[model samples]
Structures are given as C-alpha cells and as structure tokens.
Target: NGKEIPYDPSALRKIREHPCYSENASHKFGRMHLAVAPDCNIQCNYCIRDFDCVNENRPGVCSSVLSPEEAIVLVREVMSKDSYVKVIGSDIFPISHPSGTIVKSKDSYIKVIGIAGPGDPLANDVTFETLRMLKEEFPVPLKCLSTNGLMLPEYIDLLDEYGVSNITVTCNAIDPAIGEKIYSYVEWEGEKLHGRKAAERLLAQQMKGIEMAVEHKMAVKINTVLIPGINDHHVVDVAKKMGEMGVYTFNIIPVIPLYKFADIIPPTLSDKKAMHDACAPFVRQMRHCERCRADAIGKLGKDVQEEIYRNRGSL
Candidate 1:
C-alpha cells in the first residue's frame, strides 16, 4: 500500500551480500542454479516450462537440477573464476526437495533466492528445509521464495524462523468461484483435487498466508496474473486485500497461456495497461515488469534490480 513505507534498499543490501555470495562467486560460471525438488502440488493452467510465468511471450525456463554436491561444486567452480555466483533454488528444497549440499562454505557469499518453477513452495517441505539450512549455515543478502499461496500459512513461521524478509506470492484470483474456472485441479498430498472445494481451500490458505505474514511484520508482495475471462474481474479485489493486509506492493502480472492453457491467447499490452490502471487505487503498481523467464539470469522486477545494482556500485 502507498501508506506502507517503501522497501529499504540498505536493509536488503546487508542481506544479499552475506557469506552465500562469496561461496557462489568462487564458482566458475559466476552464477549457478539447481533444482533438487521436482514435484509440484498444484496444477495451474497457465504454467508451461517454455514461457514466462507472468507473460508467455518470452524464452522458456532455464536452469539445471543438480544435487547439493553438484551445486556446491558448480558454484565453487563458477565463483572461483567470476567471484559473483548466484546460487538459485528452483522448485526444490531440502526436506521435500533434497539437496546433496546443505552447508555453505565459510567464504560462500552468494545471493540466494527461490523461484516457484514447476510447483509451489508452500506445498513442499523440502523447500522449507532448503531455506532453513541456507539461513542457518550461510545467511545471505536476500532469501526469496515465489508461491501460489496454498501452503503459505504452514510456512509463515518458517519464513520468519528462517529470516526470510522478502517474499512474492502469486494470486491469480481472489474470488474462489473465478479461480475454479481458471485452475483445473488442486494437487495436494499426491492426490488430484478439484471443484469449488479445491478453489476455496487454496484461496483460504493464500489469504491466511498474507495475514500471517502481516502478523510477523515481513514485507509482503503480491503477484497477480491477469487472465481475461476468468480472473480479470477480480484484480482490484486482490489488490485491495493485499493493501489492507499491509503488503508492500502489488505486481499485476499479465497471464501467460502455457501448458494446459497454451491454446489460449495472451492479453494485449493495451489490455494489461487498462487493467493496471484499474487496479492502481488499491496498491503500488509495478509499471515496468519484464515478464522474466522462469530461470531468469537477471533480477525479477527491473526496478528492484536497478536498486540492487546501484547499491552494489556504491558499496
């Protein structure tokens, strides 16, 4: 919300430049990502490996799945040469998402962030363990996770416990009725769940996740994918809920027609613009989103990246 203070760049810098970065920088590629976890608990109609999660017009997912040992060796090799390794966890965690490497090198100084690749973080316990291990062993400058919000509550404590101060949760529909029309099945506990019941449960958990975040005083950012017929009508409500719940900003993403919904057409730039305008009254609207790839080599929102770079240069 506008009333909420903007994110403190100084605070973020302290977290991103921790020992994790040093270890990753010692690797050969300068940056490396590994996905030890492959299972996903939810089936989103728009998620396809080859398109942007927010908008499907770009290159597909990039990043490899490596065991913890492989990741450590990769990071060490890359950082040894470039000394700026970015250790990324894509859809994998420690417990549910096992890793061969749990401990970070004392010199590991990498920027570690988690992306919701083929699944949601809230639905996976391995992801939680990965986060916990990272926090315990090598606290970095930033620890981020992307999710769909279903298991958000179950992990709010973990986020706080792990010192994860920044988070992004994707909320396509605030209205459960609308969500049912967009999502095909709800995957939970290895079962295919469906109907309004699934939608309701998902939405409720997402809302609770937000509430729990607010209670913990962590910065919350909501990413809403705008689907034309199904969830386009509910963006503002989503924004309002985020604002009221004390979220720092609202990233209104354009729907990417991928996977099961690949045949569906993406919204036009003008349509997205109009929707952005409509939702501006409720939360901070991100105007220059890049619709980054799943395994984006760079940052997520350009603005935040710019801030990071600027801060880094000054340091």
Candidate 2:
C-alpha cells in the first residue's frame, strides 16, 4: 500500500523540535525555560504574582530567578544528565570547552531554550542580555520567547536578529472593551495607564507586534485566556484576525480564576470545546497547553522542575 502525504517542508521544519508547537513532538522533545526576566510591563486581572507553589501551573510563577551564567549552567547540567535533551544541529552530545565549561552541541538533550517569564521577557533588559549571551555561547538550540506583547513591537527586530524564530504573545482580548475588564493596567514608557485606555494601547501594541513577527517569518502563537464572562465570547474574533495575520496557532486556555478575577468561573469543557470548534475554521487550535509555570522544564505535560531543582541544590 502506497499513500503519499503532502507536507510543507518549511512548516515541517518549524515544528520538528518544538514540542509546544507540535503535538507529535510534544512526547519526544523537552524544553527548558529560563526565568531570567522578573519584571512585567502589564497587569492582567487573572494573574497573581504572590502565589508560588510547586503544584501551581500558570504564568508569573517561578521557583527562582537565575543570572545568565547560572541559566547556562543549569541547561548544561540538565543535558549532561539526560541524553534525550536535544538542541538543533547535527552534532550529537555536548563537549567541554577548554575552560572546562560545558559547550552544547546540536545533539544535546535540551532542544529548546525558552525565556517565558516570571514576567514578560521583553520588559526586562536582562532578558535581552541573557538571550544575546546564549546566542553567542550556545547557538545550536532553538531560541523562543513569550510575552504580554506590550513591548513586543519595539523588540521584534532585535528578537529576529538574535535568531529567535518562535514567539508567543498572550492576547486575552481583541476588543479593548473586553480587554479593559481583563487587564488592570499597563505601564508604557514608565507611565501607568488604566481602564479602557490601557487596554486599547495594549491591544494596539499586541496586534502591531504580531503583524511584525509574522512579517519576520516567525512562528507566532497567540495565547488567549478564556474567562467565561470576560473574553470567552471574543476568542473567535481574535482567532479570525490572527488567521488573517498568518499566525501559526491559537492557544485558547480556559481562565484560571485568581487575583482580580477570583470570583469569575472558569469555562466548562463543553464551552471550551465549543469555542475551539467555532475558531477551528479560522486558525489552528492548540488543545494541549498546560498553562505551564515560568520555570517549567522537561516534556509537555510531565514537568521535571522539581527534580532539576533538587539536583541543583536550590529552587
């Protein structure tokens, strides 16, 4: 029996090693997120930075922050312990540098180097510096970043320059009115903006930044938090626009009731499925997102941050 399955080479290449982007690779590939960035430029109602627990899986939650050097060491340690942690390239296994430092190769275990925040990666200068250092030192792995999109427009060029091919922007609402209810405030150029004005500004920046990322040929994924009464109804609209902008995927995550939106109920499974069905025709829907922690490590659903932290002797 012979059957030919047509495939887009570029698309296949894009999702080959990134587990977050490819459902198939999710079981085979692992990712390491460096919590180097600790400052956020915007505030979403569903986010609570004060809560930190090993069981909690959400943005803005990380066990600890590490310097660029420490982050590199952590990656090396993880790869040294596991052979499956692979980065991009043809070489198999990591080699030691002349200075006794571990040099990562194409065949290492950690395939992806992601900067996914204890906060928005673009908001902190440390994030750029860390990425630059990683780019210079370990150029084999796939570099990825996630942000709130407030500062994304200004940094899109820099990110592309640094060889960052994958970007995730959390866009809870396409409409400013709905966004206003979701985001408490946004700090732009050092000024605090509140209410509808803040939401409008954030939405504009998110859309513009997404457009720029798509123009740069970056694999863009929009993360929409589905708060039942807030932006649930507006997700289809967001997906439609994202499709128009050529975004690769849309991750519609059910809102975790917390912080300012504690009283609001999370969307039921049926409701979530209904939204995905509605938006299925517009863009690719991500049904497997774990709403991972900022310091999340290892495979998609089975996180190994605890083991890594224990082996490293600290949080």
Candidate 3:
C-alpha cells in the first residue's frame, strides 16, 4: 500500500503531512474540522443530518455550525492552544483543564484546518467566507474540504484561491444506475433532480471535478461509502476510474447505515478490509479514517469531542 504514491514530490510531501492521508503521520499531526457549512446540494440516501451535535461520532454531524468569524476565532484558539473556558454555539469545545477549562500544550496544537461539514461545503457560501478568513489568520495549516462534488467544479477555483490544496470527494458509484440507488436527489444550478437524472448529473460533475482538481495539482482523495447491496461490488471500479484520473488516495468507508438506508446492514470489518484490499491495487488506500465529525479537533485518536466528552469524568 505504501508503494503506489502517484503524486509528484510536492504532492507527496503534502500527503505525508496530512493526518488522514498518511496513517503514520496521524499520530503526530492533528487536524481540526470546522462545521461551518450546514446546507447540502446532494442528498445521499445513507446520509442523515437530523442530529447535528448529539455526541455521536460520524460524518454529516457537528456540535454546531459556526459563522465565518466564529470559525476564525476557533481556529485561532486551536492553533494557540489556549485555555478555552466556554466557546460559542453549544459551548463548541471543552478544552485544556478539567471542569471545562481547556489545557493548552504542544500536543494539542492543531496543524491542519479543514471544513468537513454537517453538510456539503460547496453548497454553502459561508464556506468561502470561512476559508478566506482562515487563510488570513492561519496561514500555516493545510486547508481541505469534504464534499459530494456536486458543486466541486463551480467552487474549485474558490477553494484553490483560499489555499485549499487537499480535497476529499464522496463518490459512491461510477455508474449512474448504481448511484441512483445511493442518492435520493441532487441540486444543480437551482434545479432539483431525482433518480437517474440526479445520479448521472452528480457523477458527471464528480468526474469532471476530480479531473480538474488533479489537473490543478491539488491532492485529491476519493471517499466511497461501501453499500453492500448498492455499490460495494462497484467500489473497485470507482477506485480504478479515480486512479486513472490521477487521484492520490482512495478511502472505502463502510456505510454507517442510516436514514433511508437504515435497514441495510452495515459492512463488516472483513467486508471493509476486502474492499480496501481490492481497491489497493488501483490507488493508495487509506486505512485510518475515523469517520470524523464536522467539529472534530486534535489528532486521529485524540479528538476533542472524543477526549473531553467520552472521557470527561476520567479527565
């Protein structure tokens, strides 16, 4: 798995620094995901945002949505590793000291600032505002965004302009028929489409967007939700196509099984491993995805929410 880095020296350097892309770096470098975007353009059947910040660890969920200004302030605090008493919107974080005082240390420093929203970032205008503000205040941390790629092509320039070099796109299927089964609907240019139409439109944009991001020399990563009856069998195809497009990494995340797809059984660890192994031959595979929340902070295993909330009494 370590042998297939398709990127040039510069891109490989960025990948090595990224916590999510590089398993070895995750233990040392930390990343913070700001939940600033709350509106999505594409509705995947397996995704549900009914519970935004509910102490659950998963994607499409957050403690709260912050404005551009608030996001900047949060990033500043995280980078400074200051003692945060209480923060905005649901007391955003419980940091540093016990009794809700955040302990600041070198270990808690956030190296990467990203927005993997409770919704699609490209669909929300505040994403740009937040990125612009972050770029101004925090110039060091690598910037990234997670999206369904519905609006990727439209916002690629904006993302690049704001120093966003890392991108993760959730593409469940390369085939429209299979995609239709995974997504309920998609919105393009103020038009709402469903079924095969929505699937095809989203797929076309995903391919084009990945190609554009690659051509721009941005480190592109593909995140595929392995739906057993839906696209599990086709994830390898997804990886192969994305590899041909020059994507840097492929992460086959097991479906969380929620919303319209709730009744479906979640993929077993073995199933994930099988898919992971199958896709490894095509592109570099990521093995350390925590399915992080939109407001996640700290390293891969020591995130703020998981550390503070899950182990509050002990701390």
Candidate 4:
C-alpha cells in the first residue's frame, strides 16, 4: 500500500519487510510461516484441522507439530542463511519432507517469521512462547502472526511484549445470524457454544479484537473467507467496519469447499474479483493471495499447496 505508515521507527520497519502487509515488498521479500499452533478454539463448517497427513495443503493442515524449542532452531537457521529454508526435526534437510518440503532462502529477500496454525495461534500457548524466545534470542527483523481474532483482546498485551508487529485476523461476518451459518461451535472460556450463541460471542470478540489491535498500532489486515451465498453480500460490511477501525489491509479469501461446506462450489475468478473490487473502497485490498498453508514458506510461496493436494492419493 502507498498509504502512510503511522508507526514509529521500529514498527515501520517491520511492516516494510512484511510481505503480506506490503504489496511492493512482497516481490522482493520472503516470509516464513511456522505451523506450531496445535489447536483451535472455534470450529468452522468449512474447517478440517488435520495433522500427520503430510499430503494435504490448506490452512489447517501440517506435517507435524513443533515445540517452541524446535521452532527456534528453524528460525535461527533461516536467519543465518539470510534466505528461506524449510527445516524439520533436529535433522534439517534441504529437501521437502514427506510431511511437506520445508525450505529456507539464502539471499537479501529477508524473511518475516510468523505462526499460522493448523489451529489458531492464540489458542496455543506455544505460540506466545515461541515469539518470546525469538525476541530474547535475537533482534527479530519482522515478526508477524495470523489468527481468528478470538483471543486478541486477552493476549494483545502479550503480543506487544513478544514483538508481534503485523497481525492478520479472519473475520467472516459481523452478524451472528450469518456467523452461525459459517461456524459450527466456538470453544470459548472452557465452554463449548453452538449456533447463534457461539456466533454472537465469536463476532463480538472479533470486532473488539480488531479494534484493540489497531489501538496497539499493529499493522492489521482483515481476511474474509468469501462463501457465495453465505457472507458474500456482507463481506463489504466487514471491510467498511475494519476500515473504520483503522485496519491496514483487507484480504478476501476464496473458500475451498470442505467438510460441512463441501456442497458449495468455490467462487469463480470473476466472482472473487468482483468482491475484491467491492471491498477495495473501504480498505486497501491485497493484490494477490496464495491463501497459503500454515506451513508454507517463502514470499507467499506457491510450492506447498500444489504438492500436498496433488499427492494426497499417495497417502
């Protein structure tokens, strides 16, 4: 985006290097997404969180879980090489593993470290711990995080302490009636909520969380999963709301029909482009989104999703 960044010197630098946050930077900058979060609080109708498959590509799929300690080792290695390399286990290999080929780059295209989960990053304690350890060990060039915004209000302070400068929140709907249609249940505060009640709580938190994140001065981006008949009309409303809250960017993600939403077809390119154009007036729209896997590495790399989906038959 060409808009002015209101952040101080340190925060501004993080946004500049962040590929997802900055359109121009993406072509020259790479990012590394660590799939360490193990669980999620809410269950979406389209979501199927799976692990150990090593053959599926999507948001909720990963080869294996990593301990905070293990995640640190990978980050350190990526930094040393000044490039993108995927590392799995103590035995780091340059090849793509069965779980997925994890690779690191050795160039000036600096990498932004982030956690996008097979589960929600905030739902896992290890996420915070990983960021904490990273901050202490070295001067983190640009740390980012992607979450559902369910736990943002509660953990915004911790994010500040751990140095998460860029955050992406997935907000599907602002209305509970629409939300209930998208999500099955939301596990909040030790209670499993269903239907409208669940959607109500989830939307409330999402709105509040986005507001809080903006106030914290973190570069905020809103990701809305475009479900044709579901939230299609309401995507603009969500964007207008995020725009009011001072969000930096808006990403309209095309839904991959799965689980309960398997019957629905994904939006065509024209449909998606229409939605993007509609939402652009309210907030700056992301030019291109690979809608990457939780473990996908590089600058919005196209490597992971293609490999995993094509080889699922081998499993």
Q: Which candidate is the best by lDDT?
A: 2
Extract clashing residue pairs from model 2: 85-108, 85-109, 85-110, 86-108, 86-109, 86-110, 86-111
Off by over 4 Å in 3: 1-13, 52-62, 81-104, 306-315
Overall local distance difference test of candidate 1: 0.57
Instruction: List, residue by residue over 1-315, the lDDT tens digit for candidate 3.
Output: 568857363346467678887887786677888878888887778767764421113744436777888777666655663333223232334454345443333523455788887778888899999998888877778898888888889888888999998899988899999999988889877899999999999999998899999988888888888888888779999999988888988887787778898899989999899888998889989888877788888777666755543433321
Clashes of each: 43, 7, 6, 11
Evaluate all candidate structures by whole-model CA lDDT and list the values in order: 0.57, 0.77, 0.77, 0.74
Rank list by lDDT: 2, 3, 4, 1
Tens-digit lDDT string for candidate 4 (206-267): 88888888888888888888898999989999989888889988888888888888889989
What TM-score does model 3 achieve against the real structure?
0.86
Count of backbone collisions within predicted model 4: 11
So what's the TM-score on candidate 1?
A: 0.70
- Which regions of candidate 2 fall more than 4 Å away from where they truly are? 1-12, 51-61, 81-107
Model 3: lowest-lDDT 10 consecutive positions: 83-92
lDDT of 2 by residue, 69-182 (tens): 888787767756433333324222222213333344333445788998787788889888888888887787889888889988999999988889889988888889899998
Q: 240, model 2: CA deviation in Å? A: 0.5
- What's the TM-score of each model vs. the native? 0.70, 0.86, 0.86, 0.83
